[model samples]
Target chain A: MGDHDAPFDEPIDDPLAESLRRSLEPDPTLVPSAERVAAVRRAAERRAAEHDRNQNGPDSLRNAVSSRSLRPLIAAAALIVVGMFAALGLDRGPDGDVEYDGDIAGPGGDGTLRVVEIGIGRLVDLDTSDLAILPTGEYYELWFVGPDDTPDAPNRISAGTFHPDADGRSQVSFTAAVNPELLPTVEITAEPGDGDPRPSGVVVMSATIDR
Target chain B: MGGSSSRAARLDPTTLRQVVERARHHDPDAWESLYRHCYPALYAYAGRRLSPAVADDAVSDALARAIERIDRFEWRGAGFDAWMYGILRNVVKERYRHVTTQALPTDPAQLAQGLVEGEDASTALLARTEAAQIRRAFAALSESDQDLLELRVIAGLSAVETGQLLGKEAGAVRMAQARALDRLRAALRGGLDG
Candidate 1:
């Protein structure tokens, strides 16, 4: 029998292996947000468009212009098309500034927070001071809960995790792929270091912000 | 090999080829399927190795690069995920260079993306304690051991697939995995006992 067929007597659910599994496997429900998916789609579209132009545009134009022998016009046209696609590949989000701010309410009413929807993704900035101390072995996680009408109905995207200082204060800045408009509710939940990917259902603080 | 065939059975051969073909042609459905298929595994691997912020950027950049270079990617024995992983390694390497040179992050707020936000505080605390113990043992392993674990567990690649990426035979990969697990178990025991 090949090595692959050599069955080990050892159980697959050995404690060490289970621990490794728990530590490594992310939350199964975790997925790319709609905005992230849209960004990728847009990027792929631009690349596909560029690829098509590279394949057909120059060749067809070359054939046509070759019949008339209009070499300079073909060169100029190719350059213009290349330039246009390059510009298309650039940031497609709004040119204007888009920002949202609100205060998170907890035992001590944690400080102000900001969510800036820039091109492609959202920038989440959180600041807290003199908040209630969390129990040992727990940290705070930032979540972006989408609006009720979202297709997922009730979905929350984890921004990331953080732990406050000795004084029960923390400042965090991170980017998330969620749409700022879709995510009006920002929640902070105390989470364990366990491998579970979903929020712990413990809402330490929460706020509704307008964009 | 039986293991190889079993894992390969999950991906229908026809659908695999079709996904690649349609994605090359810029079919939205195909692209979405491909993206969704690879994103979770890629995110897990990158998130463990780097901060969530860098991990997200690396995944996005890797997918964009794959889309741009899809035409050039030939269907080798491995699937599309393997090819994408190769690109992702390069991107992660670039970021790793930057991270290693910079001073470690001092912000107490900086934490990895993965956390258990379950309802029971006591359960969560026990889980965290166990997780921390496991992490310490894992860190005690050799770099090669860590890499193998990362590829198998974090990347969620089957033994045969991991073998293909590492250019080793399936038999050798299985042996390595067994030995690595054994070492990890010993390390964990030592941590608990000592």
Candidate 2:
């Protein structure tokens, strides 16, 4: 037979209830460790990425990434460069292919913009002008930040490095391991040209690849 | 159910909604905030019901599951932590079934147990002995009694929240909780008498 000594109406503050709470309480120190939180957060982020991939096919994902990265930037800087840059960035060539354009904003953002055709993924007909010539020995490296938005190496893929000419203008483009359309954001970092593998904290410019 | 409210009720509902919205958008900062807010209580609940190692796994798996199914989650006033506990309850139940059917260990707590942290010899020994006694007595109760106690004390849920999770009215949960507590008290006394 079970003891029914206590009133059923009040279970919160009774002696037995307090004892149960205390007996079952876990060690205070281990309840919410940072390591556990980090592990769970990483797992959640992985699931989020997987969910994104499943919802949008790889082809559509390219456009999705492009739109996601660009929407905010364009909304913020919509009319800032209305007449400054002649190329509207959305202009299509005679071949009926639309051109993708974006603003490189940071240290030397003055009149600096990039135009490329990322339809098939890689940079095709990459064009950029009005770049600030860096001091000798410092070059600019291009990077594509994936949808993860983490600065970690796996998500930050380096496209390549290039040097500007005496006129502060140069254009040398090539294929990259990751599709710009898929990653959708371009980050230009000022590197010391010493062949360091990781991106330097000196990010000079960031641009959104508007599809 | 009318006796007390959940810890989640202390958090502002508007802020929780905003955090949930941000988390659903996959905002890292917002997600981290949500994780930190819910992890400790959920961990304690899992650790109490299962071993620490299994608790860790269940909490991680539950968080991942919650993230995947976040879009389907609607704010029904039960709060986010309650929703998370709901997922964790199912995960722990599944794990409990698997672990119970396995070979019994020298420590019966492994049958479905409480987590004890290691400490200095004398203090650790004393705490462990008491915790073990309570745990054993807790295990002796009927499944429903054990579950009600676990949901109320281990999960630290209020009568209302427990009622929501268990699909019982607050008044019913309180009545059930009182009965479960009486049994637990008797078990503890029985340990003392023995």
Candidate 3:
């Protein structure tokens, strides 16, 4: 037996305590199944990401970049821009697709945001890394912020809401009926599930739409 | 004697601290390693008190809660294991409350039978009578005594760690555990005689 099984300040030879300990030992077959372990792992990864976000906030990527030399930041941006072009080249639907791409950064992390006009509605694609997973009853909202918007009372159109994957990365696409040029700025906010249509004002990621 | 293979070896304090630090930063591998190390003990504690299905649910719930609130966990004398026990304790109590109301098995015989049911046929056959008797005596113990013994034996917590989780001094935990053992002995003897 490990030292943990040794009696507390008493001799280890106590037969009654020994008997109780032996009886209480869990059945070897009582181990968690593979599915259960996977489920737990998924939950842990998500919680870890959420905890990271809560501790660092939406500016985690910026803060990390700001503290280090500009080389890594420049490299990360270059990589993202290259990735955006590569994706757009393959993903370009037809003539007059009207694609606008820019950078989104906040507590969750930094990534490229692409808005493509697909005749009926605008398709918003967000590819971000180090995004935090929100707790249940909370969600991340995407918005089109107008130029004349104030911090307190902003005029914005809601695109949709999404939660990031357990790995703190989001590569999600949402379609909304809004003109990107009219709104100018794209923003993401962490919203509570209070059934309110208004933004929670907790901006997670934001970027200007390249016209 | 029957099911020793499932028991997880405790991590040393230094390694545990490092793992916890990495886990706090949202490291998936770190979180996986930590959970794997802690799962056995947590499951043992829950499994003894609850049915197999309920025990699994309770451990899962406790782990989810732990993940949700891991940022707020601070390193102290009791370490992360004890902190996890504290969380599991709450989950078990909540489950016990619900299960009791539903009239699920809460008696010594039922608990003993549950243990036996978990073992394979050969192990069950070899240790059924003695194990069941011991379990019955243990189940007959006061709630506090049961908790103390479970922490010390099933969860493999040291006296100091058990005390920390139970909100008592180490010396006091030792004293209480000794008295609990005496009561268990009397109960066991009575069972054998009767």
- Leading candidate by DockQ: 3
User: Candidate 2 on B28-125: residue-level lDDT in tens?
Assistant: 66666676556656676665556666677778777777777687566543457767776676666644535532121326455334545455554755
- Looking at chain B only, the TM-scores across the models are 0.68, 0.70, 0.75
Candidate 3 lDDT by residue in tens digits, B1-194: 11233533445667777888987776766766666667667776776677667777778777777777676676544567767777777677644535631223435454455454545844665566677778778878777788888876656677776665554556766888888888988998998998
* lDDT, model 2: 0.61
By lDDT rank, best first, the candidates go 3, 1, 2
Give the deviation of candidate 1 from the true structure as CA RMSD. 22.1
Question: Which ten residues in a row are the worst by lDDT in model 1 chain A?
Answer: A1-10
Clashes of 3: 4
lDDT of 1: 0.64
Better of 1 and 3 by TM-score: 3
Predictions in order: lDDT? 0.64, 0.61, 0.68
Cα error of candidate 3 at position B77, Å: 1.9
True contacts kept of 2: 0.21
Cα misplacement distance, residue B50 of candidate 2 (Å) = 3.0
Which stretches of candidate 1 lie above 4 Å from their native place? A1-15, A33-35, A61-211, B1-18, B100-128
Better of 1 and 2 by DockQ: 1
Candidate 1 per-residue lDDT over residues A51-139, each given as its tens digit? 88899988997688777567887789999998986687533323324466667765323578877666657888889742333334556
lDDT of 3 by residue, A77-155 (tens): 9999989877777456452365677678753346888888887788889987434444356678899988778756767
Model 2: DockQ against the native? 0.10
TM-score of each: 0.49, 0.47, 0.51
